[model samples]
Target: MFRGLGPEIEHRGEIVVIGLGRFGSSLSRTLVDMGHEVMGVDLDSANVQAHAGVLTHVAEADTTNEQVLRQLGVAEATTVAVCIGADIEASVLTAVALSDLGVPNIWAKAMTEPHGRILSRVGAHNVVFPEAEMGQRVAHLITGGVLEYVALDEDFVLAEMTAPASLVGVPLGESNLRRDHRVTIVCHKPDSGRFTHTDRDTVLSPQDLIVIAGRRKDVDSFGPSRR
Candidate 1:
């Protein structure tokens, strides 16, 4: 008899995801889609029931209790993620328990910078602020021009934007874009076709989606302004 929805112990490669709330469930589902086995845990029965059919395993357990986690075979997992949101104390305690259990890889979500630092100090190998990161990313896109934006680093970004009229028909080598704009066009996609790599000889067509990479300011300036 198992306390969860699946077998008591899964194969070695499975990931232990603690918390079945929005973030945890979304992550676990994605992992499952990617061909990874995910064992999901949550204190809320509703949350557990919601993901019972999606995850490889679903359990209602207090991950802060090392014994319970051990009983669930979490100690043998190579990776564990603590997606406990709102409750800082429970998140920290769960992280501490995971560390004490010697889980090799620990990823934890934090609501704030201070919370992230605390999680890192308590042995979470990676601390992520999903809400904060998404907010910042949306802020960039809402300013206009860019259709998609990904920050590769604090000052670097890769962005997608529609081709400007001035660049259409002209080969990229003759456009002086890199010299004048300080950004590099990495790829382009026709409105009806898939994206392909770009080179200096590539000619832009009006409204083609171009992916460019450079320092944040440079790429932002090169993007066409919202019409």
Candidate 2:
């Protein structure tokens, strides 16, 4: 029934989003915009009505019920995200149902450490704390020359930062970044060009924007201010 929503829908598998709260709704809409066929499920009738026509499909159903989820073809979805952060019981139950159905990827929103652990044990492939992650990103942006920060794990991150003065004209092989700060420069963008992968002989320019990956502490130690 859902065809022609976007060209990307033709190639990508359907995505099932449970819980029509702010996070779930936003995720569904963004995925739709990206050309994926998204089915949004929620227990609230009002929420389903509110998102009608905005997503590929909107159903008011209790996702904790495995039968209801199956009726909506959730098992066929390539990925399912349980975005019920407030109700721990409901979130856990929904995640369990998805897992029991052998959903390939189950991403759940967790509110606390214990909650995340429970979700992981119950079959959630990925547990994310949106608020906590956003706070860390904001802290990084305000602290140094960091333009963007993407957390790859609890300790490691991929960060984009302005080239420090000390690095200008220094060859990548001679910079000793791995030895001095324990960070690796993955790529760089010159003053007026697209990003390019770095090589050992690549020299840093004052106006370059570099992307680095390492432990959070090591990345902070290699900040532009430290030069």
Candidate 3:
């Protein structure tokens, strides 16, 4: 899958995405684009019908209801994303319900620091504040180089790129990227996130994605290693 869910992800048994809001809708789109079979569940039949073509299955039900989720085959899903926005209650409830169902991974949405803290306390695998994080990402992208930076911590950020034409034929250890770009080369991806390219030794072809990290501004200014 595009996000490096790994090669085994193609064996996707099933996937249930709860809530048909903008966030959930977009995520389902991206997952489908990644060539995975996804099921979108929501309380609104109209919303569920809207994504019927995009997802393998569309179920209109309250995901927070354990029985409804079970009927939707959520327990078999390797991952479930709860994208209820504003209604943190629904989001938290859905995450908790999914966890109880033995879903391998449960992702919840949070609107604030307190919400994140609470969601983390509830046993959710992860809490996402997408809008805020995306704003920061777009802001950094507009600044250039680190167009889609995602912070991993207070001090570390993950960035993306089309391998800088300058650093075409270089390998990691010899690149000294940390000293020059103030970022660490985490992984290399060829042609977007379509596949992991372990052969960093292969001269970088155009549009290879370099996943890197460093301090906020430093990572933002960091470009592909200069030849």
Candidate 4:
């Protein structure tokens, strides 16, 4: 993701993550596993100590303090992610401090739409709502036919769903999905086998999972009735 940073930057330069909650901790650990230097920070001493051995560096500090951030060299990191979703004040203050310190990349977690807007206004390069996104995914999964759903954006989605009874044994070419539902089948996975590229001639079975992409509304309407 930081490929645009170029090779001039030292390889050992770290990615600093503040607020060692579930999202922050998981992101730090994943970056470490991917062989990148990571520094995890939190106001809670226990959170910092919990990840001491797992992360490259662990620090306990109030990230909203510009002095503390500067002392920790937060501005020198390749990127900084502010993960204090529950505390809007801290999240916004931390982002502002990072921006003032000239951190090139700043990501933040927001608890609500208004919070996200505030974070962006305060110089967060990216704002993510993990809880809201997960809620949408789980809602789709529980909607009967949908096996999985991924939101590509606010309006578009990629979904995998069971072949509806109406579509069972029908050749893909005759389904008229593109014309009627405004969706395109990307692939199909049988219950017992790997996914295969789908073509017009491919026939869907009741047990098969069809991966489709289109507008969120269209994709939702393409599948069978929910249980």
Please give the lDDT score at residue 133 for candidate 4.
85
lDDT tens digits by residue: candidate 1, 31-106: 9999999999999999999998889899999999999999999999988889999999999999999999988778
Please write out the lDDT profile of model 2 over residues 124-153, one tens digit for every residue: 877888878888899989976899998887
The RMSD of every model to the true structure, in order and in angstroms, is 6.7, 6.1, 6.0, 4.0
**After aligning candidate 4 to the native by TM-score, how far in Å is the CA of 155 from where it should be?**
1.0
Name the runs in model 1 displaced over 4 angstroms: 1-12, 224-227
Task: State candidate 3's TM-score.
Answer: 0.68
> Can you tell me which runs of candidate 4 are displaced by over 4 Å?
1-13, 225-227
Q: What's the ranking of the predictions by lDDT, best on top?
A: 2, 1, 4, 3
Model 4 compared with the native: what TM-score?
0.88
| lDDT at position 161, candidate 4 | 79
Candidate 3 Cα errors over 4 Å, as ranges: 1-12, 144-148, 152-154, 159-181, 184-212, 220-227
Please say which candidate is ahead in lDDT: 1 or 3.
1
Candidate 4 structure lDDT: 0.84
Worst 10 residues of 2 by lDDT: 1-10
Q: For residues 79-162, could you state the per-residue lDDT of candidate 3 as single tens digits?
A: 887888878888788878887897766777778878877777766766777777777878767866664677776566778776
Each model's total of backbone clashes: 0, 0, 1, 0
